[model samples]
Target: MENNTQTTIFGLRAIIEAIESGSTINKVYLQKGLRGDIFYQLDKLIKINKITTSMVPVEKLDRLSKNKNHQGAVAQISPIEFHDLEKLIEETTNQNTIPLFLLLDQISDVRNFGAIIRTAECTGVHGIIIQQNGSAPVNAETIKTSAGAAFKVPICKVNHIKDALFLLQAEGIKTVAATEKTEDSVYDIDLNQPLAIIMGSEHRGINPSVLKMVDYKAKLPLLGAIESLNVSVACGVLLYESVRQRL
Candidate 1:
């Protein structure tokens, strides 16, 4: 991650906003299934909001905290501000932008996110969209992993990725998902067209909901022993192919 990226966000009000705003939070450490109105509200919100959570003992919270009465909870926020999908798309179109966009469905690794941003910037991707929850925070580690590319690229966080995809499709931009199950290599596809490439979490691949909505699902040819490439590397492969075709 980059040196300037934020690693910790404390205080009760800060934690509440991080949860409610759908920021890319890696995890929430609570004081071990705590019982109280505030704690209970946080817990209820955590479950209802679908934020990844961990109930840790007080000792663990102590280690994570500054030892200054943390009220049984702490939340970590990424340094970067998440972009809005519709706004980004609209801005590009209204500006007559020749756009290349990337959509990530639940990728949780900061390093991978950083790497992909580096690659996206290199390939001229207009922006990258990630789900606010279940995605990696743009912490110091992510910025460092991206080798400073995270700052150069625009990142958008959304509550539901399906709606984002639908909006893109409505704008005449082809939505493509990279999946191993497909027979077509990205090379076989036409990247010259205005397109949005979708990648999934390293473990799950693209979400089933997002995958079904894609205009086309393409896969990279696996000619070697390795079953697959890392999501970031796979993204580079697919994206550069688009760049190649466009050139």
Candidate 2:
């Protein structure tokens, strides 16, 4: 994610054009003390559309844009539309089949997210939930890693992971946190029920605050000298078990 060239749209007019083109602007960076009619319009548009924006010094913008004629703006352009979590749940539940979802807490690795999305699509998960910030940026690398699954899978970006879990729980879906803190193996869970699987970040497992709210904490058994599995593999394992059970 260092050189986010693929995801960035620079230049003030170009950024504004992106917004007008219905591009999902993840976040916008504006030069501090920047002033102009165009700038004002962009500000007004950002406020009207509720797009995320931050004021940064020109030096920072320059660094991010790699000395391009950015005209004091940089935006992260999203390639796909984010599904509404509530709406997704409603639609999935209305189908009368067991709803399976994947909730990612700080899953910052783009390739890993893509890989999980691929597996989720194969296992027929209803949707994937992630925090609006701190989640991996969907880019070419992610799409490549996913083998194009990123485009097919329903992705829901929420403000807070904990809040998403609460909503899921209230909707009669069991929140399962995959972490080693619990002795309950993934096999112990009844995946046939409405369920949401919580996968954590690469470096850290699920957030402690989120883990407390989860309905069940499940772990995949590790028998080898290694005690940990790649988050993507762990996700696939958790998902396939659900598939295995429902069959």
Candidate 3:
């Protein structure tokens, strides 16, 4: 059944079918102590796909499934299809314009993620890449908060953000991470080249490992006493700077 921003399917068999059919599942809520041949099959599929799962009370599943017999499992399907990173890079590179992409390192808040998508669309970003596990799901709230820009932007889920960095670098795209750790300002960076800008999560800035891999580290100038900007706002400043440089 379709809910606000996600389509949910109950029953172990139904969820297994959904997985086999290539549905992008955001998460699966499993009732504790679920064990059966069908449940095992579903568990294996979820492991192979690395789909997030949560152990929830039966009452929660009851609520999610609207009191239907969920067979101890409920899957929330992603509202938007995800793109393949390598294919997207190849396609973007083939175009005449210089490729511009966004890599989000575990931005977990759905509203913040949606706002970033909205800004990315407005800034002409070719695609957005995020880690599969730690990032926010593109759910109903995200779509609504994005003002429908979630449907327009091509988003790719990677196993690890570093894997994406390697693939993008291999494709001749330079990466720039937005962080307060950098001495360089975003305005000083040359963003007209094929590039991907990395924005870290809200609490912790960019991961140190990711920082080591980036071609450049830059920060938005802070005139106030505040040490950092909100992830979405910082992201907007960085993206618009890229746009201004390219123009």
Against the reference, the lDDT scores of all candidates come to 0.81, 0.88, 0.92
What candidate 2 gets wrong by more than 4 Å, as runs, is 1-7, 20-22, 27-68
Ranking by lDDT: 3, 2, 1
Q: What is the TM-score of each candidate against the true structure?
A: 0.87, 0.84, 0.96
* Range of the 10 consecutive residues with the lowest summed lDDT in candidate 3: 1-10
Judged by lDDT against the true structure, how good is candidate 1?
0.81
Residues 63-86 of candidate 1 have per-residue lDDT tens digits of 778786777887776676667788
How high is the lDDT of residue 43 in model 2? 93
Deviation of model 1 at 237, angstroms:
0.6
**TM-score-best of 1 and 2:** 1
Candidate 1 residue 29 C-alpha distance from true site, Å = 2.0
The Cα error of candidate 2 at residue 127, in Å, is 0.5
TM-score-based ranking, best first?
3, 1, 2
In candidate 3, list every pair of residues with a backbone clash. Answer: 5-140
> Which scores greater on TM-score, model 1 or model 3?
3
Q: Give the distance in Å from residue 85's predicted Cα in candidate 2 to where it truly belongs.
A: 1.2
